[model samples]
Target: MFEWLRVFWQGRIFFLARGDQLPRFLNQALKDGVVLYHTQKSERGMRAQIKLADFRCLRRAARQTHTRVHIVAKYGWPFVAARWWRRKGLLTGFVIIAMALTVLSQLVLSISVSGNRNVISSDVLERAEKLGLKTWAYSKNLDLNQIAKALQEQLPDAAWIGIERNGTDIKIKISEKIRPSIPKEAGNLVASHAGLIKEIMVIQGNPQVHEGETVRAGQVLITQALNPSLPSKTTAPNSAVNNAVARGFVRGRVWYSAEKQILLVEDKVEESGRVATGWGIKFGSRVIMVTTQNSPFEQTNKEVTSPFLQPWRNWSFPVEVIRVNYKELHNVHLERSVVEARQLAEQAARTEVQSKITPMVQIVEENVKVLPSNSGAERVRVEVETYEDLAVYANP
Candidate 1:
């Protein structure tokens, strides 16, 4: 008990002493007025603790007695204070911020939203404020995710709604679904892309390019003005074609290319099996405890669900449970050889080029070119040729 008390009052060091003169070493330490406690014999040598104040005197005693000392551990508040005092600024700032958030979290400070084009921001705020999410209201029990979902349902144009909280501020982001566009009607058959004219089966139009001629994008391959001076064999089998909209198939050989760069070094992140679950209660527009707490993991993936029924469709129920689950993630870096990088780049290039062509179109010829690389990435470009219908509306 005295040893423990002495250690608390002052600071102590645990050390091991080795040499043939162990007994002489202790005698000299005591004669030198050095304090020692918890003395015991171990496999290495005699072990003991001395006051940090006596540490310098003990070293002198060891050298005079030809005994070597090895420090095993340090104890007491002085060492602890010294270690933490270096980070005093960071610790003080963290405490101040934490206290400020604690007081502000109980009251609603600000509510702001963005990305709403057709839906007015005031309408969204009005709906949320009515649902118990407003300025100066209790924010401790309000599930922002639920509020976002409810507000999204009220706005017909919104495709998705995401809500985030920063201290006392709540922010809402919205994404609207895209509307389709109507294409103009076909007037004269024109080349859809730059290609070599392969075959033209004109139904009611004048042949503007020969079979071996090259045409630019949007160039008229067939016109409605069927000139009599043009070659008769190029026209479809009929008496004489009228000025009706030109309709027929014009096959052309076109080339499409795509380039992709693959990195030799990559970082892959995955769950590390450590999880933290935070719990909270939601009553009306306030959320408490769980949702207000920060995640424990440095890097984590959060999964949360709200138990409250929203006010969408003119219905309202503001009480529910909330659980925020966090999963820890660890990153693993991988390095690949040049050969592997080139293979990945080629696959990516092929996938990208396929998106530029129609589903039924078959690649007639394919070529791959790789630039010489001495760094960590490989660049590959893939070019493909295809023969398909090149006719499109010749809009003026």
Candidate 2:
């Protein structure tokens, strides 16, 4: 109604009124050249708003009718209402477009495979497609349980499979199965090396050995016993009694050796380098330059991206980014005297040797040799001796 009045007034006319007298106000406004009328009334009184294009004629008529005393003053639409309509008109199209896009985006465009080890992502996607996952399809239509079962059937190597929908994306999680090794035959596994018994457990065979006993490679810890006291006749032996079995556990010391070379020089040198970029783009091994200028540093590099091509529908696309950086550097030298060089070399060698030995192994001895090299530099060689408590398991 107010919109109609604005059109009628055409930026002309005026009106005023209070509650309980809006009818009378309209009558007065009509006579005074206020062509259109709008009224909002409450307990306080009535509000009659009119356009100003014909205000003079309407005012004159109102005065003649003795309605001037009720006329408050000329005014436009309330500030709150005017601003609301203005904003509504401005944002209506944008709001509609946003809502439509949001609805359209609810489609499960594709199934994305994530956290997969053995199963290929493409295979997972193909299985999802068979399970009703597809482009421009509603996410609610997807049956996650059915999809998971289909994926498992397609990828038997996967031990675990699950499907989920997050927003517009469908995720397929796959876990690969790890094969269990078959246990060796009764006596096939023996102590690989010699060691004193530290622990013992007997599962399937009779334990011939006890804890604290020393054992060697090929030594049996437990033996299968058919009869403990029965004596066999010379003519015939019981087949069951002949089939006694044994099992054992043993830990043995294994020898290992490592060698390291150290170069002694008057000065030790080191070099260091950086790259920054704005937007991301890539093709093959090369990345397109998105930045306006080359990096200020002497070292800079760019790489390209190779994007995957869709077989059927060509909708969504992605790009890869690659980057490499180079540096121009000169070595900064630190001079070391002969005495300092010898100490540093020895310390370095000791650390290197210790890293190669296990914590369980005790260092029995160490030998260090420092000699002048033909290159006019000192050479350091160190040998370390260690011992390990190789323990074995015996069953009783």
Best by lDDT: 1
Candidate maximizing TM-score: 1
Where does candidate 1 have its weakest 10-residue lDDT segment?
A: 177-186
User: Per-residue alpha-carbon lDDT of model 2 for 1-396, expressed as tens digits?
Assistant: 988566544542333443344566567666555555556655655555454545555555454445532455534445444566789866788789999889877887666777766467877776677777877888776677877866664553454577777777777776554322223323323443455555565544566556667666546555555544565553235344444444333333333333333444545333344344444465545556565335555434443323344334864345554333333343556656767777777787777777655443446667787765655455677777644323222221
Per-model lDDT = 0.78, 0.54
Off by over 4 Å in 1: 1-186, 225-243, 267-296, 301-329, 394-396
> How many clashing pairs in candidate 2?
25
What candidate 2 gets wrong by more than 4 Å, as runs, is 1-261, 266-270, 273-280, 292-318, 323-328, 332-334, 359-375, 385-396
C-alpha TM-score for every candidate: 0.41, 0.31
Instruction: In model 1, state the lDDT of residue 182.
Output: 17
For every candidate in turn, the CA RMSD to the true structure comes to: 25.9, 16.6
